[model samples]
Target: MRVLEMLLVTSCVLVLMVSLFRNTINRKIGTIAGIACGSLLAAQLLFEGYRWQMIPVYIVAALLVALLLFRRSKITKPLRFMILALSIVLLGVSVALSVLLPVFHLPKPSGGFSVGTETFHFIDADREETFTEQKGDKRELVVQVWYPAAASGRSGEKNTVFPKDRGLFHTYMQAYSGYLGLPAPALDYWKYSRANSSIHTDLHPAINPYPMVLLSHGMGVGRILHTSQAEHLASHGYIVFAIDHTYSTVVTAFPDKRVTGFLTEQSQDRLFEDSRAILHVWNEDITFVVDQLEKLHSGAVASKFKGMLDMDNIGMMGHSFGGAAAFEAVYSNPRIKAGVNMDGTLFITENRDAMKKPFMFMKSEEFTNINEKQAKYRKTPATDAELKELRLTREQFDNILANRELELKLMDRLSQQGQGRTIYIEGTGHYNFTDLQLYSPLIGLTGMTRSINGTRGAEIVNRYLLEFFNQHLRGTESKLLAGPTEDYPEVKYPNSVYQGE
Candidate 1:
């Protein structure tokens, strides 16, 4: 909970307790308590903002203040007791809600530049929208760009973590809750979230023509989930583009107020089988976005990106299924120099030997070691007694062994394509690759993320991103990627071969 809000809850509890004993307490004590409650309520609203979770508490505080007006009237003891019990329950509920789904902060940017962001709506006429109901519709994309910016803009204002539009933001909140597979009401406090970037801040002339990156979210996820990473890249002198792949996103709110939710027929477990066609569309989306980048400056109204972007030095990256798409971009798109995939398995398994780009996969330990799960069973077969203790049927154990063999075979086929570097973050899970890990501490508790501290995970991820992009995009190089260092012990290159240009 916010500072003023916490204080108000404490004052409300004290006032309610005093009111419950008003017959024994001085009338002046009740008056003072009511005044304090009213004053604190005003301060909370002025500084801390209102929330639906606090509505019950707000009602209780208002009732306490109103009692001061009727101080001469005698109150029944039972009624006072009821008020006390109800107030305590309401306050307790508010505290729990706020703690569970906090208005989280993005870790401060470690680079020299402050971040600035802008959103653009683009439509691809060449490709028809395949997932839509219309007879003929072009694919529409919502792209948000983050760039290095001056310390202050005219308003000196920063952007909200989600959309500023109330209707859209509320819809995003609903979609995010669904994304996490949580109940809709769980993340309602997300409406008050903040980001580290300012909107449309003036860019220094020297910062122009920075290296670029196109960011894609995980399958069925929104682009804002990658905001923290994008901001960090921008601060480090790379212009980053994050796309809300429309129907594929958890939710997308267009400028016309048309809201779209996940329309893709892909699930996490089925992605390897179901995502081939979807991958092509996302690849096209990335290509079309690059094409649109060139056209933005051609219009009569000069785009803010005019001459401020280095289109030739472009890099690509994505999390989960987005990761595979990044590999596709670097492999197929001549304009893309390098890419990284985080914790996503490949959907496009064919013709990948042609992949010679500077690329790597930053995976969670669980995902990285998946092919080796059945290794133990082969080395020292378990006895019937052990199998019974584990409660696995003979066939189930056989199936596990078979699955591991198939995964290993698939990985061997991938290895034939070429050497690929992989960085495994210890005590991490798939969501750790995106800002969703930092949504709340409860995420770690639920095993959505693992034992890694969210902020530490972000720091490690950003440092590598800065290093990789610097070596491939900018003319600089860092030893972090050349070989493993004592620094960032959480990052490992197990079975990894550092690719040199």
Candidate 2:
């Protein structure tokens, strides 16, 4: 909570306690406490801004202060107790909301430049919507682009970091909570969250043609889920484009006021089959975005990107299912010079050996030796019924095993061809690869994800990510990639071709 918000909650409690003993103590003391709490409430509103969730608390505090100040009316004993009980309930609800929907702070970018962001919508006319068969409808996508911006010391500029659409954010949060079986109210605070990038700002002139990096989020995750990584790369002079894969993402809001939610299946076999099909769609989306970039460079699309994009130099990265898509994208499109998969299981089975460009696989501890029996046996702590509800069937496990074997085989093949590197963090989980780690410490406490410090994990991921892209895409020498330094001790290189600290 912000400072004033904390003070507001504290002062409310203090005023309530003092009101309970109005007759036992001097009436003057209760009056002064109420005045102080009222002052704090005003300060909170002035500083922290007003939220609907705190309206009840505000009303209770105001009534408490008004009643204390105007003590001419002789209050009965039962009335005093009733007022106290009501205040207590209001305060309890306010506290619960504050805890569950914390205003989380994202880690600052370590790079030298400031970041600028913009959003774009594109329709791919060549491809029809396979998920829905509405005749004559084409596939559409919403993308957020973050780029290195001209450095300015002034930080007073109004910026919309996350999606500014309240309805869209609320729908996204509702879908997320529903997917996790959490109460919708548990994520209600997300509407207030913001990002660090300034919107539609001027691009940095230091580098005319910035090397572009494409980012893809995990399945059922929003594009902004990787904002931390995107901002980091942008500050370091890379134009990052993150896509919200329509129908596969948690929620996508288009320009025409239409909102689409993710498509889910209960059958494990159908889920796997659908994943492979969706992987192809995502890969096509990447290629289509790349095509749009080419158009932007050729003055086909009127915008600041004209002649500012180095289409020949590009890299791609994704977390979870998006990671698998990145790998497939590198194989499918020669335009993608390099790719990184952050703890994603490969779903595509055919043409896995075609990848010849630079590639990196950053695995979580749970997935490091996934083909091993012990690794496969280490099931999540959820109950059997819960697992069933989550769709973790035996066939799903078999698919995971098969994907791991294929991943290992591809890594080995790429290494032999001098094009692959694999590394794993010792105490990390699948979600650790994205910005979700920075949102809440309770994520680790839930035993669903491994307990790794969020800031430190981001630093480690950012360091390697920048190094890998720098070495492959920008032709910069990276000592971190050649051989790990003592800087990040948690990263382990399991393959003989790759080195660790």
Candidate 3:
């Protein structure tokens, strides 16, 4: 909390204590005030709690004080009635924000992949030219591409950003601290805040172009969240380009030293519209990147990337909102031969019916036979925020079952066009598919939260992804997808072999 907020709360508490025992004012109020102030100071020092974000608690105390002040007013006792009414209203609002904001949280560490990987930092002037606002200016995004490199022990691993940006990130987190059980306004306890940098992967000369896959992230999440999956795929011979959608990511820093943080725009139409725009950006970026690789392969520039790209095969995948974007992009762009959706709420688009490419849907527990408590724990962000429109317990659980049903429907639809498949991971939550889980553990931030063991999950998913892509895109046979083997017990594919009725 801020100084002003603290003072307001302190005064309110003191006034309320005195009013509660008006008959024995002097000693009782003094003791109560002393206790309250001492507790506040102690909590601040011991737990590193924030003073500003506790506004809800403070607001309630303030109301209690105001009620007392009303009773003691010089004009009339009727003023007390008005004051009590106003305080009650204010208290209600405070509780509402506390419940709805999700202002505080301690996320579990999903962990990162231990497999080998390499990084390429590209400063795209053309990309800089593409991001134009209405005022005739362009915004450039610094994209870091992670891929598999030769087996050389000389390269070191990359790290993520920390410490310097923690204050800002913490401030932004105040918007949703309540749901996170975080220290109201201060999150100094989080291990990630001071542990490491976001730079993972080593810098080395490109090896094989490998199969290319593009990745998109959820709303308000960074592209780095997909590191576990990306690094794992790269280790197994797949080049992954994770796009950092601007203004949507919590914090995205470009090569030019410019950083654009989250800018809230809540309109559903506008949100998906932005996703579509980003999809176009991603398409153009991938096209340009492939062209660059082609040039390098042709000996145009003195480049290390030589004979490394296999442009004939490409795939795309995304999580949450990005999942919807991936579907839309595949429908609109023929370049994407395959696509996957990771527990995303389908968005409106005119092209879903026209899509002919192979697709997959991997749902969380919410998209399967799971309870709400368990469903929310999964990585899939619940799309129903409106109470009136909320799905019933049975309905919501059935939605997960429905997700599988939809997968079958889509697959049957895809078979009509020639190819399709689906896989559902049961025990995992939403963040399991992302890098944040791994990063969290490195910083000692996992605490009591549940996240997919990023390292293990990455290897499993990447192995399957590579096998799937190779079989479909490169015509390489893979027995892994033929059936569920006992080797991988964590994976439960109820629909893969049986073909859900």
Candidate 4:
């Protein structure tokens, strides 16, 4: 909650408490509490902005306070209790609404530099928008770049959360709510949250020619979902470029107010099948974005990045489908010095063996093993009853195991080359890799997330990302990656720890 929001909520509670004993208390004291509650409501509206969740709070509190202040007769004990109970119920609903869609801050970057970001709309005439049949429709993309910025520098700001004009936010989030199985208004308060980023600030002189990382989102997920990780990377002295893969995200809103909804949809089988080419278009998108980044640094284009990007030492990372695509990028692009894949299935099978570079595959514990929780704690295989609850038939279970084995086989082979490693985070789910985990406190109650707190999950993921990139790109090393340690008990190395070592 914002400063004034907290005070207003506290004041409302105080008023209810005092009103419960209104008859017993001195009239002066009761009146003062009522006035304070009303005053705080005005103050919250005047200072901090109001959200829809607070409406019930505002109305109920206002009416109760008005009754206390203006109504002359208070002889009926039963009537007083009814009003108080109704007010309490309304306030409780408000509290639950607030918790379900609480405005939250990104985990503060654990680095010296501040972060700044800028968005660009680019069209590649060389590649047509394949999702469309139009003859001249080119590949359009929205790229947001986050970089280390000087605190003193002047920069324009764009809020990803809670912008004053929210038409774009509504359109974007409404498209996503369907996938989340939530009502359209469930995520309405999300607009009230904001990213901890400024726009297009001068690069921090401390890290000139900062190593760059290209970030990619999962299939049907927007780049906005990865803002937390991207911001953290930028703060720690790296340039992070995240792309909203056109036609792949839930929605993409351009500065021109033209919006495009997700256009690409295919079966999982097509993703792994070579004939389908689910990754082919995405592979080109990654390569093309890098081409544009090169142009920015070429001096031909007027850009602050002209001499401030270490384009030669680039890296790529992604979540889910994006992670799979990162493999293709690093495997195909020699300029990408390192890569990380967070909980993404391998979509590029052909190039798995031929490539060798610094890479890390960050997996969630459940993705690593379905019955890991029971197996680790109780030393038993998942029972048939557990399988029923998991909704997995024995055949499906076997197939999944087979797939996981193949994945681990590749991970182990890759870990043998360069500075590659694979580790899974315990008590985390797939969305834990993205900012979606931080959306609500009740997120864990759903199957999408597990036991890990969203903030703590973000911290752990960022810590490893910084460590991995610092060692591979910046010539630094941390013992945290020199096999697992007590420092992060949640991080578990599968099979042999640090196979490359």
Candidate with maximal TM-score: 4
Arranged by TM-score with the best first, the candidates are 4, 2, 1, 3
Pairs with backbone N, CA or C atoms under 3 Å apart (clashes), candidate 4: 162-191
Estimate the TM-score of every prediction. Answer: 0.83, 0.84, 0.57, 0.89
Please report how far candidate 4 places residue 220 from its true position, in Å: 0.3
lDDT tens readout by residue for model 1, 43-120: 988787777777777888898899864667777888778877887888888888777767788888988998888888
Report the C-alpha lDDT of model 2 over 93-143, residue by residue, as the tens digit. Answer: 887766654677677788888888888999998889887869988999999
Note the Cα lDDT for every prediction shown: 0.79, 0.79, 0.53, 0.79
In candidate 2, how many Å is residue 199 off? 1.5
Error of 1 at 309 (Å): 1.4
Error of 2 at 97 (Å): 6.7
Candidate 4 lDDT over residue span 1-501, tens digit each: 667766777777777677665665567876887788888888888776678888878987788678667767654678768877887788788878877768887777878888888888989989888888889999999998998887785765755543346787778668878888788787776766778888667767754588999999998878988998999989888999999889888888777989888778674333245312767888899999999999888886687788788987898999998998898889888888889999988744544765768889898977656434423423445569977996777665545445545665677777777556889999899889989888886877777778898888988999999998988888897788888888789999887422221
Off by over 4 Å in 2: 10-32, 50-101, 152-162, 264-267, 270-273, 349-351, 374-400, 445-448, 496-501
The worst-scoring run of ten residues by lDDT in candidate 3 lies at 189-198
